[model samples]
Target chain A: MNINHVDLAGYLTKSLDADEHRQAEEHLATCAECRAEAESLQEWTMALEAVPEAMLLDGPPDDADLLLQRTLRQIRQESSGANRRRSTLVGIAAAVVVAAAVAGGAAVGRFTSPSDAPPVAQPPTAAVSSGPTAAPGTRTATAVDATTGARITVALTPAPGWIRVKAAVAGIPQGERCLLQVVDKSGKVTLAGSWLVSEAGADDGTTLDGSALVPLDQVGSVRVVTEGGKQYTSVSL
Target chain B: MPGFRLQRRREVADEALVRSLFAEHGRAMLAYATQLTRDRAAAEDVVQEALVRAWRHPESLVNGKGSVRGWLLTVIRNIVTDQIRARNARAPEVRESPVDVPSDEDHAEQVVNAMVVVDALSQLSTEHREVLEQLYLQGCTVTEAAKALGIPPGTVKSRSFYALRALREIKSLSPAGTERSAS
Candidate 1:
């Protein structure tokens, strides 16, 4: 429904009367943007409800200064308390719960999202090709194996405990099994991802996402190698 | 030297996240907990637990999905629910209002949705926010919000529509927002 008739605010907030509510419900089912807006606005109210009257009435309780100190002290110790509550109702993150994102990445060229709420679907390989404008804090490197003339470009995005490795490998022979490895400073190798090079993948190349358990502090490089352990190419971070 | 600097930066960023969040939203969190439990000491405990959660999942803050304050508030609400359920379990006879049965699944979902909503709401104008807070948070009807907000009822109805439409555009749903830009 257009703005003229639908009271979305009233509809989402349940402020609409019975007849209005029924009409709005039918309208929302067909209207994608309105539905999305209703969902977010509904969640916003839940967030706003958490706001204590005291916060708007004035500032925090005067005693809250001590609360911050106590909080810091808790962190210094075990920093443990009530466990994580649960996932959000939208839990739309479930939509991308790609069980084998590596295969999906190689087969369809979709980058595996490191974030829980990843974008709808981003063409990450294109993003890496245009590396001059990668998101701040992301690092990119390119390496070419002179022997095989194989080329690989890697974009490394750091996360909490691991690194998101997006590697585009071109010139590898078709039907060759490959493993994506993250090499840390100490020479420790963690398998961030693995994929089979398809015909299309071997010809035009394929971009896939992998992860390395090593922290950003210790990451040394990203490498693509055969199942036989022969390195196709390696790019130092 | 760069490695050392990078490590140092990461460490400081983590600590700064917690301190900055507390500095910005600590008071409001405490107020919310106090409102929920109606016990000052217990409220402080709830806020502390929520802060700890925020610290551990610092990714939750920088993910660009939602405001950290919104996540904190949701966590606070979840913790209070669990606390009430736990207390009621200990002494079922002591509860004045019936204890809410807690579900771990519901807790997680509320936190995530609230974060997304809070993030999208951040993009709305103050007028949009006010209209939402009235009709949604206070459960005020168009007429009631008009009286409370000193605007015409027709204005309240129209404002709510526009506000919801704006929030809709800001949210990146699976289907994606319509062509309209919230800005």
Candidate 2:
């Protein structure tokens, strides 16, 4: 019997009719192709069933409080129905700043001789225009990487009872996992978030947004660290 | 006065429901999202969006036929799909590599499977992953998977053949052979 692929799949899934099942079984007892296919399908099925249990051994990231705070902030924003307009305005402002920085930096580099060009372009902090605060206050900070010419701009917003930290980082290497850590005046360090640089973003940069449960007043500094625990840059608040 | 009291009671109930949902399934949902997005920050965004959506339609929690976790996982899958679509649209020049686009059913299956399998799936070509997802996970017939994936049924069979062969060689599964006894 020349068993078709569909017939084999049907037999494996038990979707075959009785006669088809019996015929396939008889052929499977002799044919090498049918037997190998059947065994492979069985192994695949067993592996599929093991997936959920396997995932349970390695659970979510360790920072549950940060996740809860971020979710609550999203819930509050959506329920209030004001998130869209605010997000749009923020998006526009960010675009303009990025465009200006790229264009201005290029212009300065073109006219200045190598010796005359200022080192590292002035820190990005000077370029950030602080946005107006609503119920939860907002603060802005920026850091520059002297060696890599990368810049990181961060926005801190108070959400409910926690501090929401959003950072836009540029010029980080692709495929490297970077972490954002927030340190309080009391010396407690909270892992705010971690992200990988997208293929495109690695060429330019990417913005990472995350929230932490620390109070705004308590935060003294924020640091971006690579997966290797090396601090890439730090910004004082 | 009675209306005010009733509203307060409903609010309390909603709060309890939301807390319970998070306590029971938050870690799993986060883990699943992290695997799908491959970025913890984006995973948080996916989890946040899904939870907020669940909160808005609190009735979903009570009325869902499957477990609340399943519903939440479905919601996360949809959001991630939309995010990937939007990103693709914005940067048409920089298309995701073939290996990056896991089939629809594979995304759903990954929610249940361990991150190790998810990592293994990432290693396979996108075509191979899609075939297994449709046949094994979605339980689609070969013909059905072919139609869904816009390939011929023969291609589906051939792909599945190679996919299973590759899965057998995946290094992550080697350790599991011994660990399965411990598990």
Name the best candidate (by lDDT). Answer: 1
Per-model TM-score (chain A alone): 0.44, 0.43
Candidate 2 Cα misplacement greater than 4 A, ranges: A1-30, A33-61, A80-237, B1-12, B93-183
Alpha-carbon deviation at A189 in model 1, angstroms: 36
Error of 2 at A118 (Å): 71
Which ranges of candidate 1 are over 4 A from the true structure? A1-61, A79-237, B1-15, B88-120, B123-127, B133-157, B164-183
Q: How far is candidate 1 from the true structure (C-alpha RMSD, Å)?
A: 17.9
Query: DockQ of all candidates, in order?
Result: 0.13, 0.08
Pairs in steric clash, model 1: A37-B168, A86-B108, A87-B108, A87-B109, A88-B108, A88-B109, A89-B109, A192-A211
lDDT of 2: 0.54
lDDT for residue B59 in candidate 1, whole number 0-100: 45
DockQ of 2: 0.08
